[model samples]
Every structure is written in structure tokens, then in C-alpha cells.
Target: MSHSKHSSLSHDRHPLNFQDTYICPICRHGHIESLTLMDVFACDFCRHIFTANLKDQSIHVENSSQPMTWRWTGRNWQAANQLDVDLTVVIWLVSVSLVILPPSLIWLSSHAFPPLVGSSGSWFPAFWVGLTFTLHFLFVSWLMAEHYQFPLYVSTKVRLRRLLDRR
Candidate 1:
């Protein structure tokens, strides 16, 4: 009875078949299939096209006109030409500029022409000045990030962990 049950279970449909499914490097999905074009594979999950190199026996993912070659780093695929910039650095620089520029300008303007501005008795309070600076800083930072193609945030914890590893 045990042998019969085992045989029946083996014949049943399995979730994965090794021969048909290929693992996708981009999404880590296993539903990649070869397209009609020879040496080309497409991952529906990630919507990425992959080209198979026969000589090297490696898969290349198409990134625009240039194909970015990736290598399996034991566990994950890493692109050979990864040009990622640290967004934290950009944000830090922008924040520092915002903190310094507006206050300095306000001080300089008031000092340069004290009688005209100060005698008017219409100076903004500290809270309003700070609020205006904050709003302006946020808008400028967002615009700069969008214009320069910089991400607002990136997960660099993995890279930091790797660097901190002693062994």
C-alpha cells in the first residue's frame, strides 16, 4: 500500500518542472520561457528580455541598446556595469545647503540695509522664516532629484553589512 501511494504521488502534477522553467535573474522568478527568437528568453514576471550566449553559457539581460552582462555571485545575479550612486550623500549635501544659505542671505540683506528694512517693523518671526526655508528646501531637493535622476532612497544596508563583515 505504501509503494502504491508513493507511485501515485510521483505521477501527480508538481509545482515546478526543472526542464521547462528557468530562473529569472531580475525578479528571481522561475517562470522564464524561450521566445520564438533563437537564443532569446523572456521573463513575463519582470518584463525583461534575456539573450543566451552559447559560447560563454551565460545569460545577458537587455538594458536599453547595450546588453548588461550579469554573473551569478553564488546566490544572486550582479551586473558587471552597475552605476548606482549614493542618494544619501546627495540628500545630505542639499540639506546642509538649505540650512546655511537662506539664513546667511537674510542676515546679509538686513545688515547691508538696516534702516530701510529694520525701520519698517515688518520683520518675519523665527518660526515663519524656518517654515519658509523648510518648504523651499523640500521643493528644491525634490526637483533636483527628479532632474538628475537620483533616487530619494536606496537600501544600502546590505552593502554596509558586507563591508562590516570581519571574516
Candidate 2:
């Protein structure tokens, strides 16, 4: 007799009401409130607009470049159209490419374009190799730090810029 196919939201005392405020799925820090009498909702923190499907118990971001949908699962919101990507495969591919691509490109370029006549070939190639390796190392380090949730404060950089703001 309930309307929702997933659960009919039967667990709830009643269906979601327009007056109800739910956590913004896009920006977890913000709260979503109904926009006037329309079916649209807006997040206070991220200023994202979302459309709600009360019957299906799903909501989708309207203002984002890539609108994503999430369904209320009684206890929490779950991604509705989330892809089935394997984390290990993704990590391995990215890591391997980071380690291999730059060096291969450097090697191929050195072979293809010989140094100009009288140009200092020795120091330039060494410098290029060192710079490439250092850049690759930094990229890999940042990726691992992000993926593993390293104890290091993520302010990392996102917050340093905010230092000018009054506390």
C-alpha cells in the first residue's frame, strides 16, 4: 500500500514533508531546506540546488556540473547512480602510469630530438630527468596521502589560503 518501491518509507511515521530539513548530500556540512513552495531544495553551506522525488525517496543536485542522485535509505542517503568502479584497479593503474609515463616520454624525446649543435646536452638531460622524477614523486605522495587518510591535516593547502580571514 505504500508508495515507495524501495521501502515505501514504511519505516517512517509518514512520508517526507516539504517542511522537513534534511542533510545536504552534496555538502555534508550544510542543511537542505525547502525552497518556497516548490519541490526544489537548497543547501545552506554549498548553495547547491536539488530536486526531490518524494515518491522514490531520491534527490538530485540541480546546480552542479555533474548532477548526482542519492536515495534516502531510511537511515542515510546512498548514491543512486554510483558507478561500480574497483578501487584497487583504479589505484594500480594510476600509480603505474605515474611511475612509467614520464620516464618513457623523456626517453623517447631524448631519442627523437638530438641536442642542438654546440648546445649543452649533458646538464639539461640530467636536470630534466631529476625534475621529472621529483614531480612524479610528489604526485604519488599526494595521491597516497589523500587515499589513505594520512593523519596529516588536510589543510595541507585548502586552508592555508584562508589564513587571511579573521578567526
Candidate 3:
């Protein structure tokens, strides 16, 4: 015959109960605490609300009562429905170029490549300036679309494709 002794810790542990020491899955900056409502937990630092499922031992942040469409990637929460783009450096370069390029071109054309006054060359400078301005505007528009993830209209995309195909 064998006798087994039950541990007090084992008796106190409930499968559905969450400890205050558990780190928040979303922020990782705060401890998770059980809310007044059942199976709900909240982060102290980030103030993010989560629902705890004890049966599966899973923590889920609610986008709604429905199943979540986002996932925590250890560092941040990402939309599972959206494709991620690695455009950090491209966005930064475009932003800096937008701020610096136009002014630099204007200054260079006015001072370094100034047109002769009261001559046919005067119209040349105006044309050059107009061309530079148009190019700058187009470049900025393209950069803005890329930065904001703007969807190109179908007709515009088809037109651009046709134009490119001609070359």
C-alpha cells in the first residue's frame, strides 16, 4: 500500500485563474491582472484588455466578440489580414527627398544656371523651371502614394501600364 501527499500549491492552483505576475502578452511592459468580469485580463501599463481562455491557456485581445484578426509578433501587434511591407528606409529616403529636392533645384536654376536677361535665353530658364516644378510635383505625388499605402485607381493603373507597354 502507498500513501501520496498532496501539495498545498497544487491545491491552490486553478486552471482558470490568472496570477498578477504574468507578463502582458501585448505590451510585455505590464503585469496582467484579472478584471471583475470573468476570463478578462487587462495590462496595467498599456491599458490593453484581453480575454483569457483557461481551457487552451491562450490569451486573446478582443477586436470584438468575434475571433481576432490580429496576432502579437512578440514586439508588436500586426493585422493578420494585411500584408506587411518592409519600406522603412524607402519611406525615410522619400520623405527627405521631398523636403530637400525642390528647394535645391530652384536655387540651382536661379543662381548657378541663370538665364541671360532681355534675350531668347530668358524663355529657356522659364521652361527649365517649369519642367523642374512639374517633375518635382510628380515625384512628390508618387512618394505620398507609396508612404500612405494608397491604392491606385484601376483605370489609372491600367493607363500607366498601357503607357509603359508602349516603350
* The best candidate in terms of TM-score: 2
Clashes of each: 0, 0, 0
Quote each prediction's TM-score: 0.37, 0.54, 0.34
Pairs that collide in candidate 3 are none
Ranking by lDDT: 2, 3, 1
lDDT of 1 by residue, 32-101 (tens): 5677645576765555677765355456767434445655343334555454467657866877787678
lDDT score for residue 109 of model 1: 68
User: Candidate 2: global Cα-lDDT?
Assistant: 0.67
Q: 53-118, model 3: which lDDT tens digit per residue?
A: 555555676732323333433333344433345565676677677756776677676778676778
The candidates, ranked best first by TM-score, are 2, 1, 3
Best by lDDT: 2
- Over 4 Å off, model 2: 1-15, 84-100, 107-167
Compared with the true structure, all predictions reach lDDT values of: 0.53, 0.67, 0.54
Clashing pairs in 2: none
